[model samples]
Target: MSPRAQPRGKLANWGSSFLPGAYAGSYVNIGSMKPDAVIADLKNGSLNRSEQRKQADLLAKLNRGFLARREKDAQIEAGIEAMEMAFRMQFSVPDVFDISKESQATRDLYGDSEYAKGCLIARRLVERGVRTVQLSHSIDGYDIAWDTGHGDIKGGHARLAKACDQGIAALLKDLKTRGLLDETLVVWGGEFGRAPTSEGKNGRDHDHYGFTVWMAGGGVKPGYSYGATDMFGCSAVENRVHVHDLHATILNQMGLDHEQLTYRYSGRDYRLTDVHGKVVKDVIA
Candidate 1:
């Protein structure tokens, strides 16, 4: 998906619009959840049997009310799945987010930044059956620092790259070691790339025409590069894969037919790729 007004907004878009019903019920922000408190509550057994029964009853009532209002089976299933996820998270969140339980070497591999922690958490989530896990790199509230603008391009990019390089490499390596890499797709890229020409003396502007995005594992050929940009890196020169094509390729990897994965909204069927996209099968393993 494309970047939105804010990182959270982009996340919301992915949850609400990109895959539509598939993820509408699973949107969560780890930043807002106090995992320690959750763990404490779980350990303390604060809810008595009677209180637990009451809460369950209330949840069932709410589920019934929700199902009554929704016509689509997918919507009903989404609500049920959300409820199940909430129940599962009560146990999973504590274990998954607890990086302290990991070995010192593992921790060192991922470094010690919040962003790096997020990447580690993403791997945990995937291992625990999470369909999608987005790790955003918006340090100090800058959503797209890769924009470069009038900043020092080499220094800025290098700093950000250094911050995430070890963590990402660690994540991929860990996944491979666990035999999960074959099934887990890892995509790396920005919303757009920087321009070939300098914006100022040392910075660059946005370049939408030619940008590089890479995907690994999940049925994609390893160590393979598809498509190309011009000599100046200003435009796509060969095997151009549009955004829609990328979406389609990802869906294909997930065993989904992009055209058939539609949700009904506002009296029409909406899909992630709109009315466009062709699976770039050449990239498939």
Candidate 2:
């Protein structure tokens, strides 16, 4: 992302991993909702685009004096940037989130679950030329959603997979049919893998020693598996790709050189992959 167009980075996904760490005031959390529904004044359809900009200008003017007090106040700049982005989002978001416009077959492809809707929306966003999209299969944390399996690993996983797998499969199929798959990269997996051994009666504990992440499209070789953990799935026994390596490979796929892509802050340069990252070339097509 261009440092000059930082305000537009408001479109960045709110997920911690998705947001840029070096760029302060770079991200604003926008859910799958129209600007009209999100902005309080527009909820009732009273403020049109022109009126929204007019108010934004007025608000900016109101903050001018307050902003002049500091040479580089990220908070003040972020406020102005948010107002500008809210105006810009008015044009694209509403239409993207409205899946009612999609055909029944298309909808059924993703199934009729909340995860389905997310997958469908992600497809729509990609179809419209969105560069990156992330989908979480279930809720956050290890207690409720994907992190669980501590008590009834069998039934728990079965039910959760039932809720999410259809949508993911449909997204891949839909994107391929639409020809977006070749250009879009879809990543699926969690922060860490579940333990092979049981925690309670059937549930598993977190195992950071080894985990798996699968990538489809975006130049990734199809069905090309790399690296492997031991039989117990307890630790890496073969090619171990660090998170930095994964980050570098992803940037390489996007035509970026991880070593050269640096952001300067506090008199030092920082990299997304830091000082240690090697592109896993074998994973590339």
lDDT (0 to 1) per candidate: 0.74, 0.71
Among all candidates shown, the one with the greatest lDDT: 1
Pairs in clash, predicted candidate 1: none
Name the regions of candidate 1 deviating beyond 4 angstroms: 1-11, 18-22, 25-34, 37-53, 62-84
Q: Which ten residues in a row have the lowest lDDT in candidate 1?
A: 1-10
lDDT of 1 at 274: 91
Q: In model 2, how large is the Cα lDDT of residue 260?
A: 98
Q: What is the lDDT of residue 21 in candidate 2?
A: 31
lDDT of 2 by residue, 11-88 (tens): 443423422332232221223333234233423268777787788799988777788877666567767776676666
Write model 1 residue lDDT over 1-285, tens digit each, in one string: 111124645545456653435466333344423454423344326775466557766886888777777755566666666655555566667787776777898888888765677777778878888878767675555666455555788988888888778878888898888899999999988778888898868888888999999998798999999999999989998999999999999999999999998877788888878999999999999
Candidate 2 has an lDDT of 0.71
